[model samples]
Target: MSRTAHVNRTTGETSVDVHLDLDPDTVTVDVSTGVGFYDHMLHQLGKHGGFGLSVRTEGDLHIDAHHTLEDTAIALGSAFAEALGDKRGVVRFADATVPLDEALSRAVVDLSGRPYCVHDEPLEMADTIGGDYPTSMTRHVLESFAHHARICLHVSVLRASNPGQKPDAHHIVESQFKALARALRAATRREGDEIPSTKGVI
Candidate 1:
């Protein structure tokens, strides 16, 4: 069976459409979000997650990436949750750790039927992330993604004390994406080539 999902979301302020494909050996992505930063992040997510993804977002960046970012995350999460359908043949758990210079982060995910987030990063850059979008905004975007994905997500920054480590925002975010992607990749892998549930139905 083909494993893929397509999602579309629109509001008065923005519109988003996304596609996802789960496969161990292939990854394809076509991301076009009005928010350049967001587009880059999604691209990294697809590359790191070991999946094929295509996404497009048209949001009121003229105001801010708030709605656009949150909505995009929600749509992508919804697509991920839907694509896993029944969670059959799914490993259902993933984890990864990555670093960019002095900045290191780790992320864990459980494609469980639950939505939870554990974010423990500082607020030093709450207003500016790599001089792009606000770190707080990224945090909220992550929350929105987790809320819609229906998965347990935990992110921890191991080195948040280096005052001078304003690490490349794009690189920092991409590293996080890579870690999340690896974890998701592992969790979604089929073990023993069998469905990972005892219910024999997912």
Candidate 2:
């Protein structure tokens, strides 16, 4: 069966749409959130996770990127939850560590039908990446995604090669996203026809 979902969300601050497909063979990705760096990160989520995903958003950018970023994540997360359905046969738990140049990050995921997030990163950024995407919003994005997706997620930047120097914000965030993608990919994989939970539901 095809695990797919489409979601549309609109508020006074933003309007967002997301399409998600968990089947690896149907993988494709298209993302536009009016923030270049954010779009790149979303692309990494889909590509590295082996999910077919699409996202489009329109927001009051004249104010800030917060609404756009948060709403996009909310929509994407909802789409993922909807596609996952009862989460039957899924592996349900996974972890991954990814490295990018001087940055190393780890992500752990659980498809527990509960919303929670714990994100930790020590990198200090120059306020914004490319002048539009705020460096601080990275954590907010993950928190919002996890809340809406109803998944337990934990992300941590374990190490940076530049221990005494300013680490590259781009690499730090990118590695986390890559790690998150891999962990989610593994956690959502189909393992059998039975639900992976003691309660017989996920």
Q: What is the TM-score of each candidate against the true structure?
A: 0.88, 0.97
What range of 10 consecutive residues in model 1 has the weakest lDDT sum?
Answer: 123-132
Cα lDDT for residue 138, model 1? 64
Tens digits of lDDT, candidate 2, 175-202: 9999999999999999898989889987
CA-lDDT, candidates in order:
0.77, 0.92
Check candidate 2 and list the clashing pairs. Answer: none
| Model 2's TM-score against the true structure | 0.97
Task: Extract clashing residue pairs from model 1.
Answer: 93-187, 95-183
Say which candidate scores most in TM-score: 2
RMSD of each: 2.4, 1.0
Error of 1 at 15 (Å): 1.0
Number of clashes in every candidate structure? Answer: 2, 0
- Compose the digit string of candidate 1's lDDT tens values, residues 1-202: 5678899998998889998998735678899877666777788788878889999889997787688888989999999888877777677877889887667789999887779988766555446543446556667777888888888898877764367565455455656767777888888886655656565653
- Model 2 residue 75 lDDT? 93
